[model samples]
Target: MREGFITYKGRNIVFTDYHTHTNNSFDSKAIMMETCQKALENGVEQICFTEHFTLNPNIPTYGHMKWEKYREDIQTCQEAFKNQPLHILKGIELCEPHKYTEEYKQLFQKEHIDFILGSVHNIKDIGLRKTLAKYSRLEAYDLYFKEMLLLVEKADIDCLAHFDLIKRYSKEAFSQDDFEKFEPLIKKILSKAIERGIGIEINTSTVEALQEPMPSHYILTLYRELGGRILTIGSDSHYSEHIGRGIKEAYALAKECGFTEVSIFENRCATFVSI
Candidate 1:
């Protein structure tokens, strides 16, 4: 066994970096093979390339992904790593799936992916960063979770990505977490996620840049208290060097939050493995 590697009967992925992107994503240019090689170098056993995918005609991500090309690269990566420890999963990180239910419906009618991470990259059609300029940091965060609650309530998503993603765009104004201040709303959001059988991701993408938890310690504790067991850890890497970054730290944090296993998905079904 690989040192520090968690195994699931030597057949299932152990949940390494599930939120990942590559050239297929609108905002990233990392090559697929490079990401795989980098994950292998970092001792990552598996990675799901959840490239940014959206159908908003008003956004840059609309029609940006060449699905055919992306599938080819995944095939190539799987073949190249067929003899190695790395297992690449096909996934898509969707923006506001609840807002584009019909589009998502059409998508699922033809395509089936292993995972989908639902995120609110924008609020009311405005970018999170732009919202900070129009509202107080606290206001922006409240709006963020409120919009996120919509997805948790309606989207056919496996998990919610970055519960406090607004913090990523509002750090300039406030470097602290405000989970307590928004506890009621957050409780509704988390409870809805559990009720809908949706999971959440501990996005470690900001561990180096922001030095903060994605959901804060409070959010993790709340999920546990609510009996939420389905969670995954991801680096949310957009570049090669970002692959597998902060994964060990996220695993430790999960353990501290009273979680023994992290989840992985295949054909959209979750399988938990010891972290």
Candidate 2:
């Protein structure tokens, strides 16, 4: 698969990870500068620190982010690496933007974030971590996909992060048959993303830990078959050591699935880089 990488004037294509977390996020412990150095060493030309900033009232991490300090830290890294080849970008991974419309609108009004990743972390107000045991298997899958469709249609984001993340925590093991049942909703979500100019993130954090990335290989292929062109690869790393894990494989998989380019964002606009 690595042999299929398209070159630009004899230069190998480098990658940009638009989704990552830092110590500013309640769940991560990665120091900003250390992560930058690690990413640069791993051949990531551009890296965006998308710290978790959620508005969900039910979650403990809500309102816990220190936005000013987070932005300051990113600026420090950007300046520190100014002369280097690695480009540091500031971003936020907003959980469930469709559920927090007012907060989403108000934050974007003042925050000068370079990238915004819209993700659905819960189903019907119950977080995914605790949701599996509360509902029937069928009900859980239904609610999850339904919310994803709504997010794709209503959330104003540059890309959808971890489109099918519930599988990572579900009580039932996911199977190809299960994904086949979800094909219709999946297609709708992909179609809406394409129409809205939003890209899909291939979250590689799951690959090292869970044996596959979020949304599975079948879903990635289906996205390409459905004419969805925009894609991004993210390690979703909470630690510096995991900075570039599984990203090369994610890019190769995208190339195999017929995606010639991966999307990167700046000030909410997408720029495509060939894989």
Candidate 3:
């Protein structure tokens, strides 16, 4: 199980896991309200239910959710937890924005989504998990970083989820040399993310599950060097036990990266909370 903590800012901020999946996502097994209820019990002030939104033509689960049903589930959770201290926000973890822009836009237009996390789970017909398993470690790292740049260049979403998630499965392939090789692409993505007013997520779930942080120190340093300021911290928890995991470490890393403010999104606009 993963541990949780209060943020460094001392806002009584509680913990907010912005990236989470429920049964709405094909790969997740937890139900929507059950996850939100767990957040409440864990003292998480806010939780964003960002179920997966895949667009790969080869995947049977692509476009698995109906917006109407998703909206209904969110509404049910809201009403059920209204008097509770926890605030649940509707969100989606978009996989490969270049392939599903229209579908994403339509969902955003119709739903009162508080946040949207852009993720590159699929690249050139390769899913992150599959890519790591099928290719050499260095090869997969290169592909992941390259596609991450592509995602940033093409998507205009709130924040980038698990910026170094490919490493979760390819840790054995990572090294100072690999980081150096991908530094340019990392910097490029951060620069573009800044230009587009998008925030990057300090995904703590990676640390909890993979034993290594996302946007590892090297990438975080590169982001700071490129004047990337906006950042959001998320646990990316799929189950109750993982809620609020590693959030304090995420905040500490952000501060170490010279970020004075952490970002939160509402109505698709970012609000910064000073650390």
Candidate 4:
């Protein structure tokens, strides 16, 4: 088991990482059950298998799992680890909500998903990673924010994942001025998210690996200022070693933002943990 980030209320808080990818996600290499086993071995009390669910036809890396096969694999994993102390919750990481809202609703209605993470990984038909490689950093950031606003308003999902993930791959340095330019749009997205009862995620994986936490400090502060209450933290770990890597820092940041608690989901309901 990995010994990491045990601080919370002066006690060891065993975390349930809610954003994880397995082979079911096209770009992931680890199998579902293997990922769960690693989590259990790493002292993770619980985890959600939030594999990618994408609708960008241009990106073949978009999820390719059939519903029947996906469910079968999840059930198989659940049963394989049933005797363990760790809990595995069924989840999906939704990408490009504006383009795939109907598909998402259909998938959710057709299956039993314990958690859903809404993310904007694309601007129109292009993936963020690809966009960063081809366009100017400012151009990519603007498109990302614009598309994110659309996702916040249109997607029917639980939590917004890595609110400013596009900035993670930027070729240029981000500044306070850049954040200032996007502040109004950020507030609007947060306001709509609050109105829709959608939760925001403090994705630690961004900082742990990508070197920039999503939503950035300014955006997170704005969310708090707008009276937003529900917030969840995720490692967004694609590999076992990265699980729970920066959660302690995220919790500290949340506390500084005036958040008294962090959120977790089970059976489609949110439960709070004191920060």
Candidate 5:
């Protein structure tokens, strides 16, 4: 077992990382087996492969993921770990889910997907980096959150990933105070998510690159204040070396924000594990 896991209700809580990618994802170089092994080595008992699945033509990873091949790889990994300590789930992290309702409707019919993560990686058909250069810093942030609100309402997703992704590339520096401007919209998104039984993801990849989680501590506090409790922590690791990275910190932040349990999904059904 991984050491230093947080204890709640007189038991140690093992975290499940729900957002991950493998070589099937266009931008990732991590092999599926290697990623799984890394997660197991880190003592992550449950790991979901939420690979990038996008319909946006402009996305570099748009047509890269082949459903059958990806499914086959996951099946192989599942068989390899069947009697092992880790639980592997098939998941997809879809970009701009609000834009392709019909496509997703058809895709899921044949896919054995367990969990889906909705993300807004573009604005007006442009990718994040270009979009940031196209608009003012604050405008870009507004655009990102505005679309997120729409995504929560329109997409059939299990959770929202990387809540404030726009900040990842903004030229202008930002801080928690800037989050105030979008609080109302974010609250609306959270309300819609709760109403729809969708959860929010705490992506920990940002901890190494930005020294903060995508949603940041302020946003999490706001989520708790709004009575939002369904949360999932993800490393968002694109490589084996980074798998399960920063997840413990993410879980600790969740606990600090008044969350007692963290969410995990199996065959699209969400269950809570005490933090």
Candidate 6:
């Protein structure tokens, strides 16, 4: 890591972890300002706080976010780091955006946002971790993909975060290498993403436990082969100490997946930056 810029094919790879949550989110206990400070110290230049935004009242994320506070917190971090190279992006991780059209539209009218991350953390009002356990690996993954496909097709989002998160609770019922059965659905999702100009987020939090990103390396390659251009990486950290845990490896993996540039967002528009 030369000057903290890892060399890959004569280029320095600088990373931005775009998937993060803090005290503003229901499941997180991290203070936003502290998380930003720690993440920057850990070699991450850009930290996007994509706090979970869910409409399902049964889930923890529902009715939990204090929009004004979350916004003010990011603004404060920006002012504090104004002279530094640190960049803070305000984003929301929308759970099932497809199902809340009116509410989703209203978010834009009332709040200023930089990015929207779509995700499927549950099925039939139940968290995937609990819902997935009730079925065989294939059956469980199939259900997850179906919901994910629906999200891709109908949701108002920039990209899908933690695309293959179903494996987090698989309990060894399926191996990461055995995703051949889900190729068709994966391809469809990738195609739709490319068509919609929505990028794919390679969530690296799993690398600490599963030794790879959420969607796996194979899915990443497939995404590149399908002419997908936009890509984003995240650590999915909820605590300050976990801020940059698997960030470097994620960029290395993206390079291996043939992406020389990655996408960053502001005001709902994307800008590409070199790896």
* Cα RMSD for candidates in order: 4.3, 4.7, 5.3, 5.7, 5.0, 5.4
Clashing pairs in 5: none
Residue 48 deviation, candidate 5, in Å?
0.2
Model 1 Cα lDDT, one tens digit per residue, 133-200: 89987888888888998888888888999988887776564444465888889999999988877889
Q: Note the Cα lDDT for every prediction shown.
A: 0.84, 0.81, 0.75, 0.76, 0.84, 0.82
Better of 1 and 6 by lDDT: 1
What value of lDDT does candidate 3 attain over all alpha carbons?
0.75
Tell me the lDDT of candidate 5. Answer: 0.84
| TM-score of every candidate | 0.93, 0.92, 0.88, 0.87, 0.93, 0.92
Q: What lDDT would candidate 4 get against the real structure?
A: 0.76
Per-prediction tally of clashes: 0, 0, 0, 0, 0, 0
RMSD of 3: 5.3
The 10-residue segment of model 3 with minimum total lDDT is 1-10
- Give the higher-TM-score candidate: 1 or 2: 1
Predicted candidate 3 versus true structure: per-residue lDDT over 1-275, tens digit per residue: 01122232324454567888887888877888778877776767878888887656676458677778888999999899887777778878878886666776675676677788888776677777889788888788788888877888777588898888777766474565776876677777788888877778888866755566777877777888888877878888777677777877777888888888777666676666776
Q: Model 2 over residues 39-151: C-alpha lDDT tens digits?
A: 98898888888888778878756876998899789889999998888878888888888887777888888988777888888776788867778877667777888898998
Global local distance difference test of model 2 = 0.81
lDDT of 1: 0.84
Model 5 lDDT at residue 219: 83
